[model samples]
Target: MANNQGRSVRQPTLLEVIIVLGLFLAIAFSFVSVVDLPIQLALFIALFLIVILGIRLGYTYNDLQEAIKSGISNGLEAVLILVAVGALIGSWIAGGIVPTIISFGLEIIHPSIFLLATLIICSLTSLATGTSWGTAGTAGIAMVAIGEGLGIPLPMVVGAVMSGAYFGDKLSPLSDSTVLTASMAKVNIIDHIKSMLYVSVPAFLISGAAFTIVGFTATGHVDMAGVESTINSLNSTFNIGWIMLIPAVVVIVLLAMRKPPVPTIAFGALLGVVWAGLFQGMDWIAALNTTYDGFVIETGEAFMDELLNQGGITSMLGSIVVILLGLGFGGLLNHIGALQVIVDSFKRFITNTGRLSISTVATGIMANIFGCAMYVSLILTPKIMEKNYDEMKVDRRVLSRNTEVGGTLTSGMVPWSDNGIFMVALFGVPTLQYLPYMWLSFAAIILVIIYGYTNKFIWYVDDEEEGQGHELDIASDQKA
Candidate 1:
């Protein structure tokens, strides 16, 4: 599909794009299921297909290489953040912060309302931290531990944890996706936030309701025997005191104060080291080593060992690699114009506000699938649909809102995606198992469609007004 200029590419037909994508997905699924290899291997397989497509399209290997580099570069900061969070978790656990939270958590947080409470707690934490990963790795883990102790299904607990985490990630001004959506759609950040509440609030309320109903109906009684054993194990393994919580509290407070994630999390990790050495009677070298190797407890109790034996930079390496691979794959697709081809193929049908909004949702989900992360979806969907919104006299904020619904909200649903891989690795819950439980994720999509079709909260430009644009005129105008 190249004309000249060493790969002036022609747009791919919809069928051509779908065939390649379908083949890539089949390879990925086969690798993950039948082969049972690491997910990164699946990404590599998909990347290879993309590379082949680029070459066939007359793109040079160097061009494809550059694209891959661009993709990996986009996620470098997140990779570092993942490593730092890993260190933070390792230190937090070794220093007794997580154990302390669980101990105190088990006492007051009744098993009956734990899921409801989890949704609220995680939302607040992620909103403050502006990171679902950090929230999931930290407070989310604590909630999972608490849920396990209460005998709740891990999927239900992880579902609640993720639903809240995404709630914050979508609405929190601190979130990159929120900021990116605002910038991309040319909407005021505050306006974007306010408008998003129209969608997010309803989704959150529904999700919260679902969690509450599940919580009250479930037979998730506190396992008094397991709880006592866990408490004893925590008390024996680490100093059980309120002082251990200072590190976690400091991290959350610093994040809430708008400190950069890298430095804030780095400080949090260091505080864990100091706290562990000073309070837990660990040698300085041993405490520092935990940052690399993570917290490891050889408690005689298998359950305690399983619960406590996680965290550290080493533990996050797999996730980091997966992210890089996904980014590289996405980058290549972008460089080869594969994503644009797909979007262009789909964009033509978006003739009105409702169709545009719904199509944007579909684009967001598709971009995440093909582009491999929320970042790409956030970038690609708006780039493709911005004109359609303007043509429909729709405010860009609605575009931004729908983008968040499709992109950030669905991040954890894709198995190899940034949020998905990290959550799976951290919680050991497979993506599909928890996907159904992310009620807000799907709710956001449904809500967007409802809002779109109903024309509620969607602002349209009026032509008869002084803005020099008529509604019917704008809607009727077609691109040459």
Candidate 2:
């Protein structure tokens, strides 16, 4: 048999394309809301429809299978990281590490400025950790509890946390999305991050200002009693102290030293297990179980039980399944030439720099919606748009930055995406409820498009000359 990669096929008609998407969405909505199905199942049902479409398009089952494998490969790394994060969460909570942070955060974070502080703190934590999932699951959960106790709205708080987490994730050299974007565009991670700041920073500033205003103007009265009770419950539940923070600090230090994410995060989890045994007086078997099954606090208070009783590799299973199914759906669509047809159709309207950039952003957002994860979007967007970038003589850094803006920053905005599901599970807020509040995440995309048209910080390659700048770009891309 011959290889099927790059084999030309009939492009899908616009009506056919809309029909598939519409069917998927209709099924998704039904399963997600009407039947009360888990997101994984809903995505699986949608995936089956796409596979059926591929069959109708004359693709063999083998070709579809191969495409599915190839697509899942793009997100395999993220799956592993998410699993490790689950283990980290369980271990950290059981070992009192997360409890210690929550305890301290509650003590120092003033109610009047909590939203602003949440933004900064989450940004710093995500910057150090390089994982928004990790930041959201750990500090984000704690912030939810704190915000509720402060009588602030959950949606607003989630927005602030998400904005910060994504901001750091987009810019952090250690982030998988950041690295993946730079790699796809053939640019240095550092250079890619530097270019991103032109859009990311301003969006963040505006978001911060909004949070600040909300903090001051929020009508909710502070439940001081609830705050004290929650803090006291945390203090009684774990061996809360400064020493418990050592594991998180160690992970941050290792990240600063350019350590890889998997081992750094795994080690942090192990440190938590050790702390559980040493400081929390937890049995070795119990601590080990925590890594597998997450922390279990039988606090009488529902909020505390919900806040503290999450984590473990087991908890991450649903998300892993959703990612695989979502990627598989996209993979099958790509295999059937459905997605490629959409990309090609856009080329006709992309007649200039601004249109090209806008199209790239549009494709990225579409990838996020259809691909259902940032990793998949990042991979697909560049594959569909990089040639256009090269043809336009635009620097790959711009493409890299735009992908982060359109894809990475918008992943959590999608209702059923892996990142969105994770946020919903972590913070207990629906994606739509928090969507409007993620001003920074949405703003980054807008700012980039605005900059794209204004010609601000947009770089281009020289076609006729082999200058030092070109050599430097080549060198940077090589290092990345």
Candidate 3:
């Protein structure tokens, strides 16, 4: 094919795209699951293969390098957030913020409702902050420790945290993914959120009910004595007080006010250092060291030491390397037209609303798997499918909603993706271990497909009412 500038460009064939993607997946899964190696090495191998594919497609090394750079650039913000979160976790633990929260949670929350409470807490935190990463690194960490104290399964706790965090992230207007999806589809952000409610609300309710039922079943295994022991260790080791919560309060207030997440989180980390010095009796230097190398304590209680002895900038280095390699692989695929070819191959099947919805979800998931970041999927999927929605007269809000359902919700399920890597590093739970329990993501995907086929809550553009604030027509036998 010839480009706009008349330069020759070889578009990848469907077979070539499949082979490349398949090989990457195989290598990644093998290294992570079978070989028990760092995911970065696997991603590096995959990236090298993609570079070879780009060369065979007539792209120069410079072109491929630029593509990789561009892809990494897109994820720089997330990379920054990861760094900030690492410091936040370390400092919070040192300053007794996390320990205090965990101690209070152990005392107040009964085992029968711990899972349900975790879901609600994480959902509210993410909704307020508009960043699932922040929520998970902060409140999510505390919840995991508390769940451990109560003898709840680690995977189940992590699953509830994941579901609640993404639930709020998908609906919050302040969320970068939500805003990007709306912008790509050329729709109002509020309309985009309202459109998502048709699916998100149902998913939230279902997930909550499931958690409640599961919590009841799981409480039979509760270890009350262990919970008390953990709480006592927390109080004996750190100055567990209401004052320690100031750092967390500041973070939430700043983020809710639309402050930049990076600075707000950094400030929160700094506050943690100050608290550690004042309350924990650590000198300024030792307190600051915790931000980079992570907090350490010899509480004599093995479980307490294991749970509290985590966080720091150094802790996130491995995940950062994986993210960079994953982004580079995604960038090279786009540069060589591999990703585009895959999407084009699906075009023929998207002949109606139902098929379109399915294709959009599939493409979003594919983009996350290949692009290795939620931003990549959120930006690329809607841009690719916008014209199709317009031609079919479907409301752009629906396009935005489906894009989020597939992209934001599923990002954490892919081990190499930014969200997935963060989750694994923070909670020490493998993506596969928690995949079956990600109720919100699964429910949303199923509901969107059902809505498409049933013609319920599907809106169409009305040419006659195109302007003057006229309402669009909802394509449903039942009232929307």
lDDT of 3 by residue, 1-480 (tens): 654345577888888778888998998899888989878988988888888877777777777889999999988987888888889889999999999989899999999998999999999998998878878977899899888888899999999999999988878888887888888777778888888888988999999999999999989977788888888888888999899999999998888788998988899999999999999998899899898999988878788788999889999999999898888888887778777788888788888888999999998999999999988899889888888887898877789899998889999999999999989989988999999899989999999999889877787776454332236544431133
Best by lDDT: 3
Give candidate 1 regions above 4 Å deviation.
1-8, 463-480
lDDT of 2 by residue, 1-480 (tens): 223655444556877888989888887777766897777777878777777776666666777788888878866776777777888889988888887877787788888799999999889888877878767865676677678766788999999999999988888888877998888888888888988888888998999998998898883477778878888988888888888888987877776566777777788889989999999999999998888899997889898897788889888887788878887877777667676778888788877777877888888888888878777788888888988987887888888888888788888988777788777756668887889999997778778777778876677776334331232355545465
lDDT values for all models: 0.83, 0.80, 0.87
Against the true structure, what is each candidate's TM-score?
0.93, 0.89, 0.95
Roughly what TM-score does model 2 have, to 2 decimal places?
Answer: 0.89
lDDT-better candidate, 1 vs 2: 1
Worst 10 residues of 1 by lDDT: 471-480
Q: Could you tell me which 10 consecutive residues in candidate 2 have the lowest summed lDDT? A: 463-472
Using lDDT as the yardstick, the better of models 1 and 3 is: 3
Pairs with steric clashes in candidate 2: none
Model 1, residue 204: C-alpha shift (Å): 1.0
